[model samples]
Target: MNATTPEDRPFGTVLVANRGEIALRVVRTCREMGIRTVVVHSTADRDSAAVLAADEAVQIGPAAPKRSYLYPPAIVEVALRTGAEAVHPGYGFLAEDPDFAEICARNGLVFVGPRPEVMARLGDKAAARRLMAETGLPVPQGSARPLTDARDLAAVAREIGLPLIIKAVAGGGGRGMSVVWQADQLLPAFRATRAAAGAVFADDRVYAERFLPGARHIEVQVLADDHGNIIHLGARDCSVQRRYQKLIEESPAPALAPGVLGRLTGAAVAGARSVGYSGAGTFEFVVDGDDVAFIEVNCRIQVEHPVTEMVTGVDLVREQLQVAAGRPLSLGQDDVRPRGVAVECRVNVEDADRDFLPCPGVLTEFVPPGGPFVRVDTHGYPGWRVPAEYDSLVAKVIAWAPDRRQALARMDRALAEFRVSGPGVRTTRDLLREVLADPDFRAAEHTTSLLAELTARRSRPHRAG
Candidate 1:
């Protein structure tokens, strides 16, 4: 069967159900394509860049995410009232909410992502692990079903061995995860993990998995249209993270073990096709000792997508719009080629010196870096107040070059040139610079635990810089 063109299935108006940089990114693409955008914002974001740049802006609710972004009813109502043909949930909030996607469908609006069922299957961490295992992909030794009781949880923990990890079955980003290094820590970790999971995802279901220490966090960028055309751009190294939340990402993952990179990317494309996925998605994995284990799937565009875009020269947002419009992909598998190296550092309003504590305040001076091969994506201005209610991310600084060394050098210069500050408002600029200069990071030998281990060492009196 042939796929329809954009003209045959047009979504002229899209309601952006997100905030901050991602919303602005979507609006920018919509403007380029001559598609109107309706930005729904909370009271705190009335003056946000996205709201100001949008074709139309609507005050959805208060600053609390539950009332504004996460509130599906308000978002769906806004789309219908504004006559929006589709809703684009960028990255976080309701991006992977299966019920929210279903509501969009019921309201005669395109969800601008995979089907609700697909989201349900891929968004659930446990379910995704099972699906990947079923597809003959490598998944860590873990429980495929939710633990029913404390005894059941302990049994699974014992089965997976002592140094296993407890994770929330419903969500990720280390929101509800704990490392149990011994038998004594199992129950407490399980309880804490469940409590955290319930608080974040409204589900207390927890599972256990073999924890691989010093692993590299890598993921493949996948694009699949409704026409069954699936292609992988490449892999990204997201190993530099704090608390499992990615802080830096680079495309063409540096120093991948022999055959490991090809296998991971191939399995990612195959996984997407087997699940009948659509639009942009990411297949996340943890590489340990020449083995890659499937972790979870991000059902929407990722925060670090700019790295892939810089390297591939593909407008992922544009491809997503076309896919949602029922059009065939503009490029085939052979056309998806990556060139150059790209690195992205997430700039957040945190005091890295004070252990990365969140320090939000009005920005007194905000000067982003520029020049060749440098891109800064932000929703902040000189006097904009950095709100304390949301994620700490203030901007994303990206740099590209012909090779990884040059890319890193460019990113270092860009970070150095960039300036953002306010009263009691601390940023991670210095920390990123320090990391960039570290020999291990420069050599691509840094793993996910490197940052945490560095932080621990930094606290020691003898190792204080």
Candidate 2:
């Protein structure tokens, strides 16, 4: 199956089937791993910073992802042409696609993620929930099947109670999801969610679940190998979010009770073991006070992976390469002890007050922060025109400190130093400043819905000095 045996075939050159900051992140690690990298780019991304960072770059197709990044055979061809032995899909766009992984395997190219079977098993949320529940993991009380037309409205309503979430079976990153507050809104919510899901994922299947109000969006970054060895890098507090997408994240979630930490870690391991989960993946959960319930599992590296890496000195992308090469995880559970606190803020190009709308344009004024405790991961410059075709995340600034308060102060200072500007671009930086300065957030007394309420309250916009 694998070229040569698991231990023999070397993980040589890697083809990064992604763009932007993640591609650059992987390329940097590949440089450290002494492995060459093949960077694939769409026409719109021909001048992307990641292309310059790679050992070799390839123009795959037009600007559309379906023609470039999502086209498996074309991407594989690029890998073959460039002598790339493996492929690393960073987060979105074919990262969790099972058929793509299988295709890479058949072509004798390593896919830097879990096996195709694992992805297929966990791709569907309802199915994954059932499997995890079978292993005694705590999953939300939800329907097993994607709603069958919402025909039995009353019965379904009685089953899931009020204030339930209507989610797409194949949803991720909050795209194909809707929340229902009352019985009257259920059918309309389901219709809208189904339409959105069909448009986004080609899956019109919708499911219902009891929404856990005030649950913290906590997750564990897990590393595993082919031989079934697994370990957890401490949890991240991603409670600061809007519409299920995290805005800021920090390691060693504050305010968790004594026994709650172990339970969260154990449940994550159990979920990983359930689908024979391997490679670097994240298991997201909604922690209701001290009680944790499984939300979903991301089978690829996440946007907030840096916080965990900063706190625990593990090069996740490098480890991902090693794990894909069929190498056993070099570090055991004890080796993953957390040392310091790390916080990451995602700087998105969006107008925060105008319904958080995307603000894409040329970077007229771009300046990133720097200090001993700060690290900025980005691929944009002053002349770079922010592409409207992709996600609005421009860059990430991470701060590390020996303790939470120091990390908080370092991040606050870094945010103040950081600056970005363009015509009519409304950013979340000022919004983040307000949220970070909040007493509840400073105390870590927040949840996934924190931003929703924060935005609902009047925000006095403060321009960067």
Candidate 3:
């Protein structure tokens, strides 16, 4: 690999348009690359770690996300006012919004992701499916476009069979999705999903696909540059999820048939090149046995990125910044080699026993685990209050080892050492431990339904002897 010189630096100053761990994560990478950072936060996060670590900080709005992080105009204004040369929208909020990218471009500030046009086309799940299918990627059997009405949805659902998934065209992060198993339950599920989609994403368009009950949720990480260079960093297994939300993720998906990984990575790279995609993105797929089907693409840094970094030894954020600056990828496909096994667990401030309900309060004590091959990405600290206005994820604990068995053991040890407490505060630490010890997970045979099944077993009533 080549060293980045002063001239190679993408932007002298970058404005981070998000909050919590992702904001802090971006600031850390920028500092290492000799770039100054400006972070915009709501009033509730005035004392956040990202704000404290940044060279400059500004208050954008109140606690509400809509008035703060999701408001593109205010964030663009901050970047311009602060003299930031670029804006990095980490993961959520306005990360995938093409209009926000265009606004940044119109103001002469670089948006550290794909071009606005490409983002707009791929941001729509239905459209992305069509494009990927045309590019020779295997797409699930479903509607090729957004359903027009109840009749259209029913027609597609019938064609796709009884068990199908209703997904919002503009949905991500597990919201606006429902699985209908019974024919009688189709319309109600459609109505509820559409309502939730409109309220959350502000777009109500939806489509249906055949649901895979016993499938592994795998995603390939890819990085592209404007110079027509793209490479896959490998794949992550995000099968351990509840309510379609991923709780744990690991890289180099285990127990795959021979050549499955290669096929998935090749398809991802081809799909990215076909759409002229740039920056860091993820291609999510559902794998049932030896068969794989394309789902959607995440056109930004993912939450489980650390797992990829652990095994690949690549700084994805650094690559994103360099690509945004019109630089070709620093390395090619031949230079990319993944080693060992890595696992990451999202430690959220939620009570797992109470149906994963969010528990927010002041933290009386916060101590993350530390040791060899263990990384903790978080914005929490002692005396810092856990705000209910944002996502419940307080920290991410990652462990790497030479093999999957050791990695799981290391993660369990790290989770055991994680000490966090406060008034009315709870976390999913215990639940994650149980998952790490599951028999099916140990054999790498677990599917996306593992978490739900675990919860169901826990909720069953025991007969008295």
Candidate 4:
């Protein structure tokens, strides 16, 4: 790998090709880096914070995501028309889309992520599992390739045993996944997952894997440069989740056996290097006891990035910009140091009691919490209507402290003080508070099934002695 000179500045102007908090998150970093920003929005996001904060804003299309954010050609055209030197697909819309990255490259704009080929390789779940296993990362027992035929799927399921998971090849963000516990449910689950995957990701290919029940969802954050320098920023615990969607994330995953985290981070760096990856990415793993298995790789900035940032004090977006500009990583492994503990909660506009149903409407009043180490990343403001067309995520509240106990306390307090009220607007704030107060969570003994168990216990009727 060759290193570029320090005089080589990153893109002068970047177009954020997503909406909501993530788009605004990118714009904020660009502003601090002295780079001009252009944010493209749909009719629903015309008054979004990202659109308002950007140096320029473009109205791409109507409220429908397909007509706006997910449309690669229109986004590329906007970048060209606005003279944007690069395009930042913040996270969801086209973040993991290799074709979108290729389109940006063909148009001579940096895509602010891994190369298109690398993304295509790692974006597919089956291919990624194969590559990681070859790179010496432990993978769960399952089919080595995608299971497209019904007979093949059943055979693999029989081999892997019952209670396995069927996942989409192009799945991410917990979307295109199903768990099969009985033999009778195998074929139906596979066909359903395949159909949903095709409808969502345009790729119906499906794969099966041995599901690790009660495992901790741990992920290592890695940063690499064009110069072949790869380093892990440490690990994050995202075990508190419902329906496979993470609600809370914390850094320096608690209560791990000695050297477990070290091995996880080391393997993550090795896997990233194996693929010649460059940019900010995450290597997710499923950990049960001391054993860990590589799950999948997210080849873009993640939603839980703020918790890692809070502990490492590294601006991942800035690192991404520098690496995208063909520059070497500013800091090496020896220079990287992590301090303190941090926790982040995804404050979504949903009713947790009602099975997490989306409750979107105009925000009548919005007041985010603030303090010494509390950081709130949000795009909502009074009178801003939450669009039901997209994700329910409205804000990410993060808190940092010297220890996990203090961090949890700070997070609880921050959530308590957060004031968001509107017509038909509901948040997961109360449920998050309850999770933080759980004894298992406080002791870091929780697993990926914690949320489900918690909800089940709450709903169970008490019997009279």
Query: Which TM-score value belongs to model 4?
Result: 0.97
Clashing pairs in 2: 350-426, 351-426
What would the per-residue lDDT of candidate 2 be over residues 1-465, giving only the tens digit for each residue? 223443443467899999999999999887766777899999989989999889899998998878988888899999998899999999899999999999999998989999999998889988888888888888887787777877654466787777888888888987887888888897788889999999888888878888877788889999988898999998999989887788999998888977888999998987898778789999888888768888788999999999998989988987888888888988999888898899999899998877789989988899999989799999888878888889999989999999988998999899999889988665778788888888889988887888988898855566798
Per-residue error for 367 in candidate 2, Å, reads 1.0
**Model 1, CA-based lDDT:** 0.91
Clashes of 1: 0
Report the C-alpha lDDT of model 3 over 1-465, residue by residue, as the tens digit: 335577867899999999999999999999988888999999999999999999999998999999999988889888989899999999989999999999999999999999999999999999999999999999999998898788987898778786999999999999999999998888899899999999999999999999998999999999999898999999999999878989999998999978889899999999999999999999999999889999999999999999999999999999999999999989999988999999999999998877999999998999999999999999999999988999999999999999999999999999999999999999999999999999999999999999999988887889999
Q: What Cα-based lDDT does every candidate model obtain?
A: 0.91, 0.87, 0.94, 0.92
Q: lDDT score, residue 90, model 2?
A: 95
Order the candidate numbers by lDDT, best to worst: 3, 4, 1, 2
How are the candidates ranked when ordered by TM-score, highest leading? 3, 4, 1, 2
Give the per-residue lDDT of model 1 (tens digit) for 126-181: 88899989998899988878887778877887677768888888886557888889
Error of 2 at 279 (Å): 0.4
Model 4 C-alpha lDDT per residue in residues 350-414, reported as the tens digit of each score:
98877899999999999999998999999999889999999999999999999999999999999
Where does model 2 exceed 4 Å of error? 1-10, 152-154, 459-465
Which has the greatest TM-score? 3
Q: Where does candidate 3 clash, by residue pair?
A: none
Between prediction 1 and prediction 2, the one with superior lDDT is 1
Better of 3 and 4 by lDDT: 3
Worst 10 residues of 3 by lDDT: 1-10
